[model samples]
Target chain A: MRRSALTSTLTFYLPLWAFLVLLLFPFYWMLVTAVRPNKELYNLSLNQLWTSHPTLQHFQKLLFATHFAPWLQNTMLIALGATVLALSCAVFAAYAVQRLRFRGSGVIGVAIFLSYLVPPVILFIPLARIINELGLWDRPAALILTYPTFLIPFATWLLMGYFKSIPVELEDCARIDGATRVQVLRHILLPLALPGILSALIFSFTLSWNEYLYALVFLSSTGSKTIPVGLATELITGDVFQWGPLMAGALLGSVPVALIYSFFVEHYVAGLTGALKE
Target chain B: MPSVQVTTAARVVRPAGLVGRVLENHHALGVMMVTPALLILAIFLAYPFGLGVWLSFTNATIGQAGRFVGLGNFRYLLGDSVFRVVVLNTTLYAAAAVVCKLVLGFLLALLVNREFRGKRIVRAIMLLPWIVPTSLSALVFYWIYDPTFSIITWALRRIGLLHGFINYLGDPNLARASLIAANIWRGIPFFAIGLLAGLQTVSPTLYEAAAIDGAGPWQKFWFVTWPVLLPLTVVVTVFSTIMTVGDFQLIWIITHGGPANATHLFGTLAYQRAIQGGFIGEGAAISAFVLPVLVGAVMVSFHYLRRE
Candidate 1:
């Protein structure tokens, strides 16, 4: 029985470990290429796993010699702006539905979520027109406006869950102390529910940063382009693909959020789980 | 002014605290708070949704108004060869990817659920792929599938698993599979983590009770875990289906629906038609095709995912 159990464990786990390695190897390979010297990278050596003389030259070129800086700046501006705007709007909407007994509240909640389910593909064409009519086409505000279509619904839903966890009695007691609704929200609810807000902000920021299709379609000028589209088109051209700098740019761009996850892993998980739950 | 008699009226007996007034009157404030959200939704979300349906009936192009050509685009799409293939591919891809994500994610969750040292770290690591940007990771895969120099191919050849070169992204069949594989890899994190959350909510005593009744591991899982997880699994499946069906980035970055239209899922196909091919009407029609399936999935899943 012991021997059979040992064999069963080996059969199940060993292959899974192998598969996991296979799954992760491409990402591992990317890091390898990012560090390897351009000369060594061209050689196709079996020992490409480790860099012989690892250098940060590729990263340097990405940062200094190319459009990487502008792209990074553009991404940061749009992402942060969108996150702040979306969260501000969503917090109020969420607070209303979760805490207050209002008319048509259920309908409002369901309507917001359904809007989130609407695919960007469904709305982009007409939305582009609306932006044009408003004289906002090719502008960053176009993205800001389009982003809340999905983000508000999600943020509202997410904040509602977090708000539910806050005890109502505390707010009631504070009410007896003569705190106005706005003051109570400012001093108590926002601080108490800060974790959920932060999570929502990060999610919204990363989403805007990573958005490709909208950036690709909407932004016309080189100055306005975000990182994903900007780098892909500029760095890669037919046969002479620029892997070293592209990977370097990618690595630098992703590191901030990756660090965010590593540091606040639990909140990140909680936020995601809560978001999905709704 | 003199007849009004400068009386203060005692300020109508103001509440003791600001909180008291707010607590007494939550509804009015709720309306005020929700107004901005409602207005934004009305302008950006609902209006555009209505516009989409309206535009489908018209021959609307980007930055230009075209005449209303009712049912014309749908007719053309019905006759288009590429659109047919896209519909087929999109359906197959969504079904296959969702199934693979569900099964693999469940298994991974089961494995990680076992007691082990550093389990929390493992769980966190498992979610890394999902947390990373999809386009960024897809770009990483693009390099891995490079024809001239690919680490994946090189490694496989070195291990004697592949003879010479493997153009994983260049070949049509292999290209679709490769995109699907990348998606499954990225998606497994969400599903596994979701299922793990569900698993934690199940009472351990139920499993212990089953064991006491002479039930084996499989029997315990079948009876207790499956029933408890069924609702969550359905919700995850629905979410995965919608996302996968609308997936464009992974395939777009990898193949651009290429090697002879083999990887043309609906989202990519729509972009290719409208943006690249300049068939605006046809693209809208193709995008509209997936709406029914998406709505159906949502309705069906809502039936199951709601609290009992």
Candidate 2:
């Protein structure tokens, strides 16, 4: 049945359009400010949203003048390092919990989930001291090591659901066919659980990619700073906010994760809904 | 009699030595599998949590250790008006942010639950705010709130709506409100996504059944939809509160507790005191205060999470 025009507009179209505008405006403004010529950006007399003289100078400056490239590298290395570490641990732990079904496994699973509830804000203060003690202070390793404190619990939780979805009968058949336990998991379970693994990787990567608090607390030196910390710190020199390149960095910083996300959008959303769906 | 004899024979044999059995046991394998995750969580998460508690009671500095001051940090925080303001701002920020996010999120969730054209694309687009890094989006907000060059201020001035540029971030109350608006903007999508998942599980059949009963739209929603959304809403709100209370990014980028410390949340305050201010003990104490609230919230929400 078709919805009437008046009811449709009032109920769906109006709110939908309004929500769209609210959400998209900031990103649109980010782009406008990024490309707008400095004169136009600063001058109030010029059109507020429209930029007649847009330039690539900010992007140029961001690449050549700043340590943005290293910041990107630093962010990439840190995110990847953390994602890999977390995913491996999660895979094994999830496999054990779901497949092995050993005594106390249920308790450990709940314990790990409980750890996920612990926020980074509380731990960062003490973690800073630990990083200092381990001599990982001011390095990417500090972030890599610390990110798992959140990522593993999350990834493990998601993977536990994934592993459980696979039938135990398949593993039983594999074993009956003389496949070793390791071989069965490798040939059957891992392939079957590929989607889950992809979701976990995407999530772990994004978690570390978008992380700010730990990066801010641990990495102080400019050269070692990740994108979030770098953008906030290095861009604003004293009181003058560098609008153009700051937006440039902001836009560019989001690209890697956004790219990864759109590529695996289906899996990401599915895994999320699946995990939270009760 | 034969079954009892078989059981007795199996019990007597026991499959061999205790050492060999333990080696091949499922529990041992389970422990081995969970070792890596357990190790990381223990070293990084568990250790630091306990350490934070210990550090809070000491008079520790950045590099120097001090003897136990025993409630000195808490007593000092009680006396410091800045800390008092921090607590007030944190509570206000969280409560306001939570209410806004839930309301807007609920509206958006209901909206998106209805079938429409290009709904998939619309839903994906709705997620953008939550997807991008807050540091980046908060910068976008920072630029918008700039005292002289604010686009919002300029637009109002141009429309003859105001005599001068509005100081969105410069005013204390305005700064706090602006930060909350920015926060709500980011948070709404997460609430929407999670609640939408909840909405999907209600099954159209439930709605159809209500419609057949001649229930009005409002009645249908209140009777059917609201009850189904309750547990999920609780789960999401609890999760959101934990994250929001612990939040540091949006505040740090937008205001940094600026305009006379109007917008400092607990996380930002803790970072300021411990990391930036180098008062490790005090910062630790500030951060620790939220623990009881977080644990309480988590315990309450645990039922909702484990409901299935």
Candidate 3:
């Protein structure tokens, strides 16, 4: 009996352990390649797990010699700015749909989300012309302007779920106590829906940070380009992939959000699940 | 922000008397809250979405705007052989990805559902591909498919699966297959977790009851599990299909719709023409064609997924 139990345990865990190791190895290799001396990278028989001599030269070059720092800064700035804009717009819209009795409100909610699902490829061509007309090409504000089209509907939907989950009596009591509707929202609903709001912020920022097609198409100059486009074009020259610097840039780019996501995994999944529920 | 009286007038929900005025004030506040979103959507989303429909009729270009050529772009697209290929590729990609993701994710959910040690950690890890920024993950795959010094190539070679080095992206047939593989790798996690959440809501006692009735595992799954999961399956599958069918970044970053345009889905092909090849009107028409189909699919799925 013990033998059978032990065999079953081994059978179950071995595959899972192997799968986990395989899944994580590429990320581990990315770290190893980022740190290993350039000479050791070509060594076919080099140990896959660890390197003896690690250096920060690749990271240094990525930061100083390359334009990674400024790109990182721009991504952060644009992502944050876009997040703020998307959230403010989305939250209000969500609240209005959830709380208010208005004409065509449900239709508007459905319409906005359907609009959000319109692919960026379809939208960016005309938007490029519009941005040109507005004299906003190559500007970070372009992202802030274009991002909410996608972010707002989804964020509004997410916040709608959260607002509906809130008890109606809280607002009723606040209204009876002479709080205006705006006051009730500010004092009661917004504070209560903070988790939903945070999830929206994270999603909006992440979406902005990761957006490539518009950032590539709208922004013309290298200085103005976001990290994804900049790194893809500038970091690797013709016939040279620049593994060390590219991996370093990728690692730097992903660390903040990955950490943020780990911290807010529950809320993040809740937001997605909430949004996914019709 | 606007004329206070005008905005308030817009907000009068049931203008009966004094209470109506107060409710109008609340309605005005709601309008104010919703304005920023409405403004952004109007200019950026609604205007552009409307313009694409308009441009589908005109011969639009990036720099030199062309004269109105009614149905010219759409008519041209219908004849274009590559456009047909793109439509087929997109349909195949979405169908294959959705079907496989459903099957594989369902299996994984079932496996993980069984009470296991370190199940929490496994669940967390499973969500990584979905949570990680797609561009970052795509870059990782880019290197994994690197012509030289690829660990995947090394593994394949070690297993004697292929005798020589495989330039997966450079070969036409292999390139499409490879792009699909990369998409499935990223997509399965979201489907798995979403369906797993749905599965966790299922009562275990139902399974026990099935067991007592002498139902085998496969029979129990078909009768008990499949029906309960159908609605969620439709929702998750349709959502992923819409996103995948219009996927731009992964293909663009990896292959640039390369090796003689073997990997051109509707999104990438639209991008290629609009941005790279500079046939903006034709590109807009292609995407406009896709939009209605997507909307129809979403509406159908959403209608079914919503509980009666």
Candidate 4:
């Protein structure tokens, strides 16, 4: 019995640490590469794991030489804009689908899920054409307009799962207390569904911030680029790969969404599992 | 917040005016409530989806208008060696990555499901890769795979495991392997966190009952845990398959479907043909070909939705 317990504990702890180390190694590499000075970065003799003296030169170059600021601003604007739009649409759509029980509500629910199924790879071609026709090509507004297509479906579905869990009976007493449908929704349901709303917000925000394909297709100008497209396409030039500024850009770009995620991770996980559960 | 005149809103519910008549029917209000979402879906999503299918039937190019030539683009794709390689590569990429994620994720979930201090923090760390933008993270992967400065090569050489550079993304086989490794890294969190949630739902009493039946830990897992986790496993499978199959940015950044197109996925190949190569029709056809599989996933998810 002692031997069995010992072996099991070893098996569990050993692999768990391995998983953590392997998973975190890349981000560690990103930070190390980002801040490592040029002299040490090229020195094959120096210890590769840690740099003796780190420099902010890469971030300096990234901020001044490149369109990094514009890209960051663009990403933030698009993500927030898309999140708000998707949430409003999702809030009403989820309420209607989960609560209204009107004719064809079931059909609409199915259609929304089907829309969520459509991937950017499939839509980008036609969307590019549409963007051109609208003369929104090479504009950040193009991304703002298109991102909600994917976001709203996901947010709506997630919110639907959330609203479904809040018992219909919770609103029964509130409605009898002279609370209107809108009142009951605002007072009784919305508060209960706030976690769902926040989760949807986080999901949509991260998704839009992380979006690559639509932003890549719609916005091409350096001044208008989002972080993902800018870092992926423009950061590298010729065979002289700029590893320093590149990693700096990557590390910086990831910080906003990561910060938001750390704050609401509990609700985020519930919303995520709830999303897949449906 | 919007105007909150529920007192006046009640009058509208009873049809005191023309607008009241519209508000009186809950069905009308439901449609009204969903209009913004419906409109967005109709114009941007549903129309574009249909347009993509139509474009696939035509010989569309970047600078020129195309006429409908039904099945012509697909006919070309059927014989195209590059497209065939793309099909093979995509299937291999998704399959390899999905299998690695499933196995590793199941193990990780099992290990993490145990009561441990700072468990929340550990799970948060696991979610890091998924949280980071794929393009940015994939750039980090690109550097890790860089020929001269590759860190993996450095570490392996340090351990006396390798004498020379590993050529992580420089050769076809190695490049495909490298891309799959990155995909697995990003995909693990989705499966781990997802299945861990499933693991928590299984009652302790069930395990206790299995224990009392003289079932060992292995037997307990096989009999009690497996059956309970099966439905969740199915859901996770469908979700992962669809996302992995259609993934583009990860491939584009890491390998760009390079090393003689050994790492080309359907999504990346479609982008190359349509956008980069300017053969929009063929690209649409390449992309549309994968629709049936995605539709299958959607049907499965929809079945779940309906059941819910």
Q: Output the lDDT of residue A18, model 2.
A: 99
lDDT of 3 by residue, B21-132 (tens): 6545656656766778899999998898888788777877878687789988888888998888788888788888778777767767766767887787787777766666
lDDT of 2 by residue, A155-223 (tens): 999998999999999998776665655666789999999999999999999989999999998998999
True-structure RMSD, every candidate: 5.4, 3.7, 6.5, 5.0
Show the colliding residue pairs in model 2. none
Model 4 agreement with the true structure over A1-278: per-residue lDDT tens digits: 99988987689777889999999999999999999998888777788889979999999999999999998888999999888888898899999999998899999998998788788889999888998998999977788889999999999999999899999888887755655566777888899999999999999999999999898888878889999999878878878769999999999999888899999988888889888776
* Model 3 lDDT per residue over A1-278, tens place: 99988886676666566546645665776787788877776665665346899989889989988888778888888888888888888888998878996666778788887776677877888888899999998999898889888889888988998999999999987766666676778999999999989989888877888888888888888777778778876876877648888888878887887788788878887787677664
| Weakest lDDT window of 10 consecutive positions for candidate 1 chain B | B7-16
lDDT of 3 at A161: 88
Clashing pairs in 1: A175-B19, A175-B20, A178-B17, A178-B18, A178-B19, A179-B18, A179-B19, A180-B18, A180-B19
Question: How large an RMSD does model 4 have?
Answer: 5.0
Tell the DockQ for candidate 2.
0.58
Instruction: Tell me the deviation in Å of residue B60 in model 2.
Output: 0.9
lDDT-better candidate, 2 vs 3: 2
Kindly report the docking quality category of candidate 2: medium
Best model per lDDT: 2
What TM-score does chain B of candidate 1 reach? 0.90
True contacts kept of 2: 0.76
Output the lDDT of residue B113, model 3: 68
Per-residue lDDT tens digits for candidate 1, residues B158-261, read 78898788888778778878888888988998899899888987899999999999999899989999999888888888878888887877888778899898
* lDDT, candidate 3, at B83: 88
lDDT by residue for model 1 (A1-278), tens: 99988986786566457546755675687687888888888777646678779878888888887887888887888887778878888999999998886887888888887777777766666676687788877788888877877788888889998888999988886766766777778888999999999888777877787787777767778777778877776777787757888787767767777787888888878898787666
Candidate 2 Cα misplacement greater than 4 A, ranges? A1-3, B1-24
